[model samples]
Target: MDAPPDIHSLLAVLDRDEWFSSCASDLKLALVRDARLLRCLAGEAVYRDGESARHALFCVVEGAVRFSSALHDGSPSLLVYLEPCHWFGDISLIDGSPYIRDAIADVDSQILCIPMQSFTQWLDQNPKHWRDIARLSTNKLRVAYQVIGEPGALHHRLARRLWLMAHGFGSRMQNPSLQLSVSQEHLAQMMGSTRQSINAALARLEGLGLLVQGYRSIELCNLENLVNHANRLGGE
Candidate 1:
């Protein structure tokens, strides 16, 4: 367990989030007034699949959360790692459904949580928000379809996955470098491949002069190359 954030700090974090920016002014005030700041330490579960809690949406304010599920044998399956300012939990909001995956902190983290009712009130006035939700669902479905339809030639898939991770979750630094803080095994699971497969893919990418890999991370040396690789393998 972690300490809760005070109103001032929470408001500061919400100010930078794109989702919060899109919110109506009244909705923003309600969230700022009512949202709880939750602190989760590294490796702690924020929420698990198949459990009920106070209904709320979560936005990471600092650190990262790894969203994952389980395998048929009850082993863990890594899905996606969300970075700070990323929004999650709307699946529950959309259908009042239980979480299908676990949201675990990748590091000591703070997140803003707003009650489901408050979220609904906001969405009611901002029904256009549904379109954003639909786009998210469609993208996930597209990923699932790729996994189901094209199971081989995994190195290509790995390249595309890395491209997406860098573009989405990673940040560009002053050195003009882009990198993702992730484990090879986690990346492997996200691509529905094995750890060995992930290693091979990284080796391939490194050989191509696209990135430099380190423990639990990879720095993109040439982002345009990564983007072009993803596009070339886009159909994968």
Candidate 2:
């Protein structure tokens, strides 16, 4: 694992992040200066479902965090993974409510947290900045809607989900990531399908030379082709 990231490195990441890039210069400075770094071990819960909000905004600086909620059967369901440069916890921060899902470190992770007090103070000073936070929440909702609204067979859906993960949802990364630290089981959970079905879907992609599955990871071999497959309007 990599060493914990320092504030300077965190600032560099925030400077390039989509949401932070849109903030006013002064607000950006405040966020970079006031942010605190949190290091979490694998499987550690950063925040639990129904827990009182930390009243802070969070961004994954390094590694990944999983957002999950329990199903009606009392089983935990995987909502999504937040990778580097992805901001979360904004919904609770915006509405002054408890977190609706659990945020856990999927692996050893470095998280940047800007305390709610600092956020509130900044917003109070310039209420217009609230729009930035609203954009954060809405962006996530838009991605979720896209995923839920995708029309296709399992393979098509899987392709889109993989593409989304590699891009950190709506990260707008110039070069999308080639590797994903996700297991077939996690993919199955995300798709609400069985492991056997996920395995079959992965096999289909593999056959098309789109990806290569590792022990618990997947490497995209042809992002262009995969994206084409994902966006294809007709059934395959």
Global CA lDDT computed for model 2: 0.83
What residue runs in model 2 are displaced by over 4 Å at the alpha carbon? 1-7
Quick one: best TM-score, which candidate? 2
Give residue 232's error in model 1 in angstroms: 3.2
Show pairs that collide, candidate 1. none
Tell me the tens digit of each residue's lDDT in model 1 across 21-78: 5556655666656677788899988899887745557878888899888889987788
Q: How does residue 188 of candidate 2 score in lDDT?
A: 86
Best lDDT among the predictions, by candidate number: 2
TM-scores of the candidates in the order shown: 0.79, 0.92
Would you list the C-alpha lDDT of every candidate in the order shown?
0.70, 0.83
